[model samples]
Target: MRIIKKLGNAFEFFKGTIAINLAVSILPLLFGGLLLFNYSVVSFGFAISLAVKEINSKKEYLFYFNNGLSKGALWFYSWCFNFILLISGIFIFNLINRLF
Candidate 1:
């Protein structure tokens, strides 16, 4: 029973960490997508490359990517950040266009 309780706690902790990582990743992912949508393939590619490099270099820091975390968590976080950033850029552009 004690062991089961410990396992439950561990699983909860893992879930919480992944949630945090996902939140952190959303903005960057959005920006990358926005860049690509704006026809800046180079910028998008650069952003992806940079993200990959950062992930690889800082894998130790990422709870999800390293054994401490999980690769899925890391990837999810990165994807979320980039997607949110791109969406935000698009929203801002639309707002400006409407204002004008």
Candidate 2:
């Protein structure tokens, strides 16, 4: 339950940049990049989201800090969650593609 709450907080922090991050993740695929490259781009997208949030939202960080989540923990959970989602989505898409 504690871990889930922390992940929720991390996701809240990540939500602001989801649009841009998702665009970055998808662009390489649209350009026909390899699967490895797409995965790397997803990670890169998350990194950019973190960097942007760090620069733009100091007070928001304090809110999470008050809730007992460190910057490092927030970043780790956010990246892990989003990366897993991306990988799962890719796998499902590939399966569908192979079938059709």
Candidate 3:
């Protein structure tokens, strides 16, 4: 239950982040669904997009800062989320291709 709630909170924090979602989804498709080799682009895109979004909204930056999450941590999470998802998705895709 606690884990679910924490995930929900994280999702909410990244609500307006569309670029990351688009990059992760489209780039993999464009690259033959094999994006592990280019996961850095996805991660960097997420970090930059999130930083731009937060910078544009001072209230958001302050909110997170006041709530104990620094900007660095937010960016780290953004990058990690996209990078890990890209790696996992590509790995699974390759595995399925090999098995089937």
| TM-scores of all predicted structures | 0.42, 0.79, 0.59
lDDT values for all models: 0.48, 0.75, 0.61
User: Candidate 2 — what's its lDDT?
Assistant: 0.75
TM-score of 1: 0.42
**Which tens-of-lDDT digit does each residue in 6-94 have in candidate 2?**
77788787677676677666766667675845575467777777777778887887899988899888777777777777778779989
Q: How many clashes (backbone N, Cα, C below 3 Å) per candidate?
A: 19, 0, 0
lDDT for each residue of candidate 3 in 1-100, tens digit (9 for 90 to 100): 7546544445556655645556544655576544443653565456556766867776876776665666676566656665666677678988999999
Q: Which of the two, 2 or 3, has more lDDT?
A: 2
List candidate 3 stretches off by more than 4 Å: 1-21, 24-40
Residue pairs in collision within model 3: none
> Predictions ranked by lDDT, top down?
2, 3, 1
Model 2 reaches what TM-score against the true structure? Answer: 0.79
Where does candidate 2 clash, by residue pair? none
- Scored by Cα lDDT, where does model 3 land? 0.61
Q: Write the residue-wise lDDT of candidate 1 on 3-89 in tens digits.
A: 455344444433333333444445655776544344432244434544554655563445432334454444444445445555676
* Candidate 2 Cα deviation (angstroms), residue 30: 3.6
